[model samples]
Target: MTDTFVALSDPTRRLLLDRLSEQGGLTLSELSEDLPMTRQAVAKHLAVLESAELVASERDGRCKRHYLNPMPLAKMAKRWLVRFEDVPLGSLSGFHAAPAIRPAHHP
Candidate 1:
Protein backbone atom coordinates (compact mmCIF):
# COMPACT_ATOMS: atom_id res chain seq x y z
CA MET A 1 0.00 0.00 0.00
CA THR A 2 0.96 3.61 -0.52
CA ASP A 3 1.00 4.23 3.20
CA THR A 4 3.38 1.34 3.75
CA PHE A 5 5.86 2.69 1.24
CA VAL A 6 5.50 6.17 2.72
CA ALA A 7 6.11 4.81 6.19
CA LEU A 8 9.18 2.87 5.03
CA SER A 9 10.71 5.82 3.20
CA ASP A 10 12.24 7.23 6.34
CA PRO A 11 15.36 5.51 7.66
CA THR A 12 14.33 6.20 11.23
CA ARG A 13 11.05 4.48 10.75
CA ARG A 14 12.81 1.58 9.10
CA LEU A 15 15.12 1.33 12.07
CA LEU A 16 12.15 1.39 14.38
CA LEU A 17 10.54 -1.38 12.41
CA ASP A 18 13.77 -3.36 12.53
CA ARG A 19 13.89 -2.99 16.27
CA LEU A 20 10.34 -4.15 16.62
CA SER A 21 11.06 -7.15 14.43
CA GLU A 22 14.02 -7.98 16.58
CA GLN A 23 12.03 -7.58 19.76
CA GLY A 24 8.28 -7.58 19.62
CA GLY A 25 5.95 -6.14 22.25
CA LEU A 26 8.34 -3.47 23.43
CA THR A 27 7.16 -0.44 25.33
CA LEU A 28 7.73 2.94 23.72
CA SER A 29 10.33 3.71 26.32
CA GLU A 30 12.18 0.48 25.60
CA LEU A 31 11.96 1.12 21.88
CA SER A 32 13.39 4.61 22.22
CA GLU A 33 16.04 3.91 24.78
CA ASP A 34 18.91 3.33 22.37
CA LEU A 35 17.96 6.02 19.90
CA PRO A 36 19.59 9.44 19.84
CA MET A 37 16.27 11.31 19.74
CA THR A 38 13.73 12.03 22.40
CA ARG A 39 10.93 9.60 23.13
CA GLN A 40 8.41 12.00 21.54
CA ALA A 41 10.28 11.96 18.25
CA VAL A 42 10.31 8.20 18.25
CA ALA A 43 6.59 8.22 19.00
CA LYS A 44 5.97 10.41 15.98
CA HIS A 45 7.80 7.90 13.79
CA LEU A 46 5.79 5.12 15.39
CA ALA A 47 2.59 7.03 14.63
CA VAL A 48 3.44 7.05 10.93
CA LEU A 49 4.29 3.33 10.98
CA GLU A 50 1.00 2.60 12.77
CA SER A 51 -0.89 4.65 10.19
CA ALA A 52 0.67 2.45 7.54
CA GLU A 53 -0.25 -0.70 9.45
CA LEU A 54 3.41 -1.56 9.77
CA VAL A 55 3.18 -1.38 13.52
CA ALA A 56 0.52 -2.49 15.96
CA SER A 57 0.12 -1.55 19.60
CA GLU A 58 -1.82 -2.85 22.56
CA ARG A 59 -2.38 -1.45 26.00
CA ASP A 60 -0.87 -3.63 28.70
CA GLY A 61 -1.55 -2.25 32.14
CA ARG A 62 -0.06 1.26 32.13
CA CYS A 63 2.14 0.64 29.11
CA LYS A 64 1.39 0.47 25.42
CA ARG A 65 3.58 -2.14 23.76
CA HIS A 66 4.44 -1.86 20.10
CA TYR A 67 4.95 -4.72 17.67
CA LEU A 68 6.02 -5.19 14.08
CA ASN A 69 3.17 -6.16 11.78
CA PRO A 70 4.77 -7.78 8.73
CA MET A 71 1.65 -8.42 6.69
CA PRO A 72 1.62 -5.00 5.05
CA LEU A 73 5.22 -5.41 3.98
CA ALA A 74 4.63 -8.93 2.73
CA LYS A 75 1.64 -7.73 0.73
CA MET A 76 3.68 -4.93 -0.73
CA ALA A 77 6.44 -7.31 -1.74
CA LYS A 78 3.97 -9.72 -3.27
CA ARG A 79 2.46 -6.90 -5.29
CA TRP A 80 5.69 -5.35 -6.54
CA LEU A 81 8.78 -7.48 -5.97
CA VAL A 82 7.55 -10.94 -6.89
CA ARG A 83 7.70 -10.10 -10.57
CA PHE A 84 11.45 -9.67 -10.43
CA GLU A 85 12.31 -12.79 -8.50
CA ASP A 86 13.23 -14.85 -11.54
CA VAL A 87 15.15 -12.15 -13.35
CA PRO A 88 18.84 -12.95 -13.70
CA LEU A 89 20.90 -10.05 -12.49
CA GLY A 90 24.00 -11.85 -11.38
CA SER A 91 26.08 -9.98 -13.94
CA LEU A 92 25.30 -6.72 -12.21
CA SER A 93 28.13 -5.50 -10.03
CA GLY A 94 27.83 -6.16 -6.32
CA PHE A 95 24.53 -7.99 -6.60
CA HIS A 96 24.03 -10.51 -3.85
CA ALA A 97 21.43 -12.26 -1.78
CA ALA A 98 19.79 -10.19 0.90
CA PRO A 99 18.29 -12.39 3.55
CA ALA A 100 16.39 -9.48 5.00
CA ILE A 101 14.51 -8.96 1.75
CA ARG A 102 13.72 -12.60 1.23
CA PRO A 103 10.40 -13.81 2.54
CA ALA A 104 10.34 -16.79 4.85
CA HIS A 105 8.93 -20.11 3.71
CA HIS A 106 5.39 -20.39 4.97
CA PRO A 107 4.51 -23.95 4.15
Candidate 2:
Protein backbone atom coordinates (compact mmCIF):
# COMPACT_ATOMS: atom_id res chain seq x y z
CA MET A 1 0.00 0.00 0.00
CA THR A 2 1.05 3.62 -0.50
CA ASP A 3 1.17 4.23 3.22
CA THR A 4 3.45 1.26 3.73
CA PHE A 5 5.79 2.50 1.03
CA VAL A 6 5.85 5.96 2.54
CA ALA A 7 6.49 4.64 6.01
CA LEU A 8 9.27 2.43 4.66
CA SER A 9 10.91 5.36 2.90
CA ASP A 10 12.32 6.84 6.09
CA PRO A 11 15.70 5.43 7.13
CA THR A 12 14.78 5.59 10.83
CA ARG A 13 11.55 3.77 10.25
CA ARG A 14 13.31 1.22 8.06
CA LEU A 15 15.87 0.65 10.81
CA LEU A 16 13.07 0.25 13.33
CA LEU A 17 11.44 -2.35 11.15
CA ASP A 18 14.76 -4.12 10.70
CA ARG A 19 15.21 -4.14 14.46
CA LEU A 20 11.75 -5.59 14.91
CA SER A 21 12.41 -8.19 12.25
CA GLU A 22 15.71 -9.15 13.89
CA GLN A 23 14.07 -9.30 17.31
CA GLY A 24 10.34 -9.22 17.39
CA GLY A 25 8.30 -7.96 20.34
CA LEU A 26 10.50 -5.13 21.55
CA THR A 27 9.30 -2.29 23.74
CA LEU A 28 9.68 1.38 22.87
CA SER A 29 12.49 1.73 25.34
CA GLU A 30 14.23 -1.32 23.99
CA LEU A 31 13.92 -0.01 20.45
CA SER A 32 15.21 3.39 21.46
CA GLU A 33 18.22 2.27 23.44
CA ASP A 34 20.78 2.18 20.63
CA LEU A 35 19.19 4.76 18.34
CA PRO A 36 20.43 8.33 17.91
CA MET A 37 16.94 9.80 18.35
CA THR A 38 14.95 10.31 21.49
CA ARG A 39 12.42 7.77 22.71
CA GLN A 40 9.62 10.12 21.70
CA ALA A 41 11.05 10.37 18.18
CA VAL A 42 11.26 6.61 17.96
CA ALA A 43 7.71 6.40 19.20
CA LYS A 44 6.59 8.83 16.50
CA HIS A 45 8.21 6.70 13.82
CA LEU A 46 6.63 3.62 15.33
CA ALA A 47 3.29 5.38 15.19
CA VAL A 48 3.77 5.90 11.46
CA LEU A 49 4.68 2.28 10.98
CA GLU A 50 1.64 1.30 13.06
CA SER A 51 -0.61 3.47 10.92
CA ALA A 52 0.67 1.68 7.85
CA GLU A 53 -0.12 -1.67 9.50
CA LEU A 54 3.48 -2.75 9.09
CA VAL A 55 3.82 -3.11 12.85
CA ALA A 56 1.53 -4.26 15.61
CA SER A 57 1.61 -3.87 19.35
CA GLU A 58 0.02 -5.53 22.30
CA ARG A 59 -0.11 -4.56 25.93
CA ASP A 60 2.38 -6.46 27.96
CA GLY A 61 1.52 -5.63 31.58
CA ARG A 62 2.99 -2.15 32.15
CA CYS A 63 4.21 -1.64 28.60
CA LYS A 64 3.31 -2.39 25.01
CA ARG A 65 5.52 -4.65 22.97
CA HIS A 66 5.71 -3.83 19.29
CA TYR A 67 6.19 -6.54 16.74
CA LEU A 68 6.70 -6.58 13.01
CA ASN A 69 3.63 -7.42 10.97
CA PRO A 70 5.04 -8.64 7.67
CA MET A 71 1.75 -9.40 5.93
CA PRO A 72 1.45 -6.02 4.22
CA LEU A 73 5.05 -6.14 3.05
CA ALA A 74 4.55 -9.66 1.74
CA LYS A 75 1.42 -8.59 -0.11
CA MET A 76 3.18 -5.60 -1.62
CA ALA A 77 6.13 -7.69 -2.73
CA LYS A 78 3.87 -10.32 -4.23
CA ARG A 79 1.78 -7.73 -6.05
CA TRP A 80 4.63 -5.59 -7.36
CA LEU A 81 7.66 -7.86 -7.60
CA VAL A 82 6.24 -11.26 -8.42
CA ARG A 83 5.17 -10.21 -11.89
CA PHE A 84 8.76 -9.35 -12.77
CA GLU A 85 10.02 -12.58 -11.25
CA ASP A 86 8.73 -14.58 -14.20
CA VAL A 87 10.65 -12.38 -16.63
CA PRO A 88 14.12 -13.69 -17.31
CA LEU A 89 17.06 -11.59 -16.09
CA GLY A 90 18.62 -11.69 -19.57
CA SER A 91 15.55 -10.06 -21.04
CA LEU A 92 15.76 -7.30 -18.48
CA SER A 93 19.41 -6.84 -19.38
CA GLY A 94 18.45 -6.39 -23.09
CA PHE A 95 20.41 -9.49 -24.00
CA HIS A 96 17.61 -11.63 -25.30
CA ALA A 97 18.86 -14.32 -27.75
CA ALA A 98 22.41 -12.98 -27.56
CA PRO A 99 25.38 -15.24 -27.25
CA ALA A 100 28.25 -14.66 -24.85
CA ILE A 101 31.23 -12.92 -26.47
CA ARG A 102 34.93 -13.12 -25.70
CA PRO A 103 37.22 -10.11 -25.98
CA ALA A 104 39.01 -9.69 -29.34
CA HIS A 105 42.80 -9.85 -29.47
CA HIS A 106 44.52 -6.43 -29.70
CA PRO A 107 47.27 -5.76 -32.18
Candidate 3:
Protein backbone atom coordinates (compact mmCIF):
# COMPACT_ATOMS: atom_id res chain seq x y z
CA MET A 1 0.00 0.00 0.00
CA THR A 2 0.96 3.62 -0.38
CA ASP A 3 1.47 3.98 3.33
CA THR A 4 3.99 1.14 3.46
CA PHE A 5 5.90 2.54 0.50
CA VAL A 6 5.91 6.04 1.96
CA ALA A 7 7.16 4.74 5.27
CA LEU A 8 9.91 2.73 3.58
CA SER A 9 10.98 5.54 1.24
CA ASP A 10 12.85 7.36 3.96
CA PRO A 11 16.47 6.20 4.21
CA THR A 12 16.39 6.30 7.97
CA ARG A 13 13.24 4.22 8.19
CA ARG A 14 14.60 1.75 5.65
CA LEU A 15 17.72 1.36 7.75
CA LEU A 16 15.63 0.69 10.81
CA LEU A 17 13.66 -1.95 8.92
CA ASP A 18 16.89 -3.55 7.76
CA ARG A 19 18.23 -3.64 11.29
CA LEU A 20 15.07 -5.23 12.64
CA SER A 21 15.01 -7.70 9.76
CA GLU A 22 18.61 -8.73 10.25
CA GLN A 23 18.77 -8.78 14.04
CA GLY A 24 15.18 -9.96 14.62
CA GLY A 25 14.42 -7.07 16.94
CA LEU A 26 16.03 -4.12 18.72
CA THR A 27 15.24 -1.79 21.56
CA LEU A 28 14.71 1.89 20.77
CA SER A 29 18.00 2.68 22.43
CA GLU A 30 19.87 0.08 20.40
CA LEU A 31 18.53 1.46 17.15
CA SER A 32 19.10 5.09 18.05
CA GLU A 33 22.68 4.82 19.30
CA ASP A 34 24.30 4.26 15.90
CA LEU A 35 22.06 6.64 13.98
CA PRO A 36 22.48 10.39 13.71
CA MET A 37 18.98 11.16 14.95
CA THR A 38 17.73 11.46 18.49
CA ARG A 39 15.82 8.65 20.22
CA GLN A 40 12.64 10.71 20.03
CA ALA A 41 13.02 11.13 16.28
CA VAL A 42 13.50 7.42 15.83
CA ALA A 43 10.37 6.78 17.82
CA LYS A 44 8.49 9.20 15.61
CA HIS A 45 9.57 7.33 12.52
CA LEU A 46 8.69 4.05 14.10
CA ALA A 47 5.27 5.41 14.87
CA VAL A 48 4.60 6.00 11.21
CA LEU A 49 5.87 2.54 10.33
CA GLU A 50 3.68 1.07 13.02
CA SER A 51 0.60 2.82 11.69
CA ALA A 52 1.40 1.44 8.27
CA GLU A 53 1.63 -2.01 9.83
CA LEU A 54 5.12 -2.41 8.50
CA VAL A 55 6.65 -2.82 11.93
CA ALA A 56 5.57 -4.07 15.32
CA SER A 57 7.07 -3.79 18.78
CA GLU A 58 6.65 -5.47 22.11
CA ARG A 59 7.70 -4.59 25.60
CA ASP A 60 10.34 -7.02 26.84
CA GLY A 61 10.94 -6.55 30.53
CA ARG A 62 11.93 -2.88 30.51
CA CYS A 63 12.73 -2.51 26.85
CA LYS A 64 10.39 -2.18 23.89
CA ARG A 65 11.98 -4.00 20.98
CA HIS A 66 10.87 -3.36 17.45
CA TYR A 67 10.29 -6.21 15.02
CA LEU A 68 9.47 -6.41 11.32
CA ASN A 69 5.83 -7.26 10.60
CA PRO A 70 5.91 -8.33 6.98
CA MET A 71 2.51 -9.98 6.68
CA PRO A 72 0.61 -6.80 5.80
CA LEU A 73 3.10 -6.10 3.09
CA ALA A 74 2.99 -9.65 1.81
CA LYS A 75 -0.79 -9.49 1.61
CA MET A 76 -0.79 -6.06 0.00
CA ALA A 77 1.69 -7.14 -2.63
CA LYS A 78 -0.31 -10.26 -3.38
CA ARG A 79 -3.43 -8.16 -3.90
CA TRP A 80 -1.98 -5.08 -5.58
CA LEU A 81 1.31 -6.02 -7.24
CA VAL A 82 0.91 -9.61 -8.40
CA ARG A 83 -2.12 -8.80 -10.55
CA PHE A 84 0.14 -6.95 -12.98
CA GLU A 85 2.22 -10.08 -13.42
CA ASP A 86 -0.87 -12.19 -14.12
CA VAL A 87 -2.16 -10.03 -16.97
CA PRO A 88 -2.90 -11.88 -20.20
CA LEU A 89 0.36 -12.57 -22.02
CA GLY A 90 0.14 -10.18 -24.96
CA SER A 91 -1.76 -7.39 -23.20
CA LEU A 92 1.30 -5.20 -22.79
CA SER A 93 2.67 -5.98 -26.25
CA GLY A 94 -0.67 -5.71 -28.01
CA PHE A 95 -0.02 -2.34 -29.62
CA HIS A 96 3.27 -3.40 -31.11
CA ALA A 97 1.72 -6.29 -33.01
CA ALA A 98 -1.33 -4.45 -34.37
CA PRO A 99 -2.84 -6.22 -37.35
CA ALA A 100 -2.17 -4.92 -40.85
CA ILE A 101 -5.91 -4.20 -41.26
CA ARG A 102 -6.39 -1.77 -38.43
CA PRO A 103 -9.74 -1.20 -36.81
CA ALA A 104 -11.45 2.11 -37.78
CA HIS A 105 -11.05 3.59 -34.32
CA HIS A 106 -7.43 2.37 -33.96
CA PRO A 107 -6.18 3.99 -37.18
Which is the leading candidate under TM-score?
A: 2
lDDT of 2: 0.95
Q: Model 2 clash pairs?
A: none
Error of 1 at 52 (Å): 0.2
Candidate 3: stretches off by over 4 Å:
84-107
> How do all models score by TM-score?
0.81, 0.82, 0.72
**lDDT (Cα, tens digit) per residue for candidate 1, span 1-107:** 88998999999999999999999999999989879999999999999999999999999999999999999999999989997788788755689867677677998
Q: Compose the digit string of candidate 2's lDDT tens values, residues 2-82.
A: 999999999999999999999999999999998898999999999999999999999989999999999999999999999
Candidate with better lDDT, 1 vs 2? 2
- Cα-based lDDT at residue 72, candidate 1: 99
Steric clash pairs (candidate 3) = none
Q: Candidate 3 on 51-71: residue-level lDDT in tens?
A: 999898899998898999988
Number of the top-ranking candidate, with lDDT as the measure: 2
Off by over 4 Å in 2: 89-107
Q: Rank the candidates by TM-score, best first.
A: 2, 1, 3
Candidate 2's TM-score: 0.82
